[model samples]
Target: MTGKLTAQPGKREELADILLQAAEGMKDNADCELYLVNVSEDDPDAIWVMELWRSAEAHTNSLKDPAAIALIQQARPLIAAIEPVKLRPVGGKGF
Candidate 1:
């Protein structure tokens, strides 16, 4: 999935810290093939995340994880919204 996240106009640094820490735990999950985070060039506060899991089950399971939940809670306020759009790669390198 991929989407944008904008911090409050002046809270970019703090928001980045929270998001980075929140993602620390998710990096080790075996089911996650890719979990990339990016800051929008046009919108400094906007963060774009791209995640690829081994299966839908893995993604679902992550939702129930405590670490994931905590991270969500921590970043909720800093995030304006999570506009994730699902995708399926048809060809070429998917990494």
Candidate 2:
């Protein structure tokens, strides 16, 4: 999954930090193949996240994880807008 998140004004860096923390935590989940957080060069408020899961179920299950839920709660208030895009991997270098 790929998502574009816009932070609430000056909260972009704060949101990115939380996401990076989430990325570190994701390392423990075997089903979580990848979790990458990126920033847009031109847009200070833009945060892009790329995630790859072993299965759709794994992705769904991650939302229920306590740590993930906590991170979500932290990020929620900082988010001004979010555009989520789902993608199926045909072939990828990371996977």
Candidate 3:
């Protein structure tokens, strides 16, 4: 999963905390390989995430998990928008 999320103005810290909590919670999931990348230096309110899982099934299953759902709920208010993009890796150096 590749996604971008924009937080409400002045709510970056709160949004980051929610994301951090979510990351910690996902640590126990065997199929989860999560990457939370804060790519917007000039705009602290924007964040990007890249997630890789064992399979699409695993990713789908995680969405319904209680902890994941809770994180989404907690982040809803602070999030201005969420845009997700899915992709397949073909080849890369050291990928």
TM-score of each: 0.83, 0.96, 0.85
Better of 1 and 2 by TM-score: 2
Clashes of each: 0, 0, 0
lDDT (Cα, 0-100) at 25 in candidate 2: 93
Q: What is the lDDT of candidate 3?
A: 0.82
Q: What are the lDDT figures for the candidates, one per model? A: 0.75, 0.96, 0.82
Error of model 1, residue 52, in angstroms:
0.6
- Which whole-number lDDT from 0 to 100 does residue 81 have in model 2? 99
Query: If ranked by lDDT, best first, what sequence of candidates would result?
Result: 2, 3, 1
Encode model 1's per-residue lDDT on 32-82: one tens digit a residue.
Answer: 887777777888777777778878889999889887788778777776666
Model 2 regions lying over 4 Å from their true place: none
The TM-score obtained by model 1 is 0.83
TM-score rank order: 2, 3, 1
Clashing pairs in 3: none
Q: Write the per-residue lDDT of candidate 3 for residues 25-92, one digit (tens) a residue.
A: 77889888665656578877888878878799998898898888988898999999899999886657
The reply for model 1, stretches above 4 Å from the true place, is none
Angstrom error of the Cα, residue 73, model 2: value is 0.6
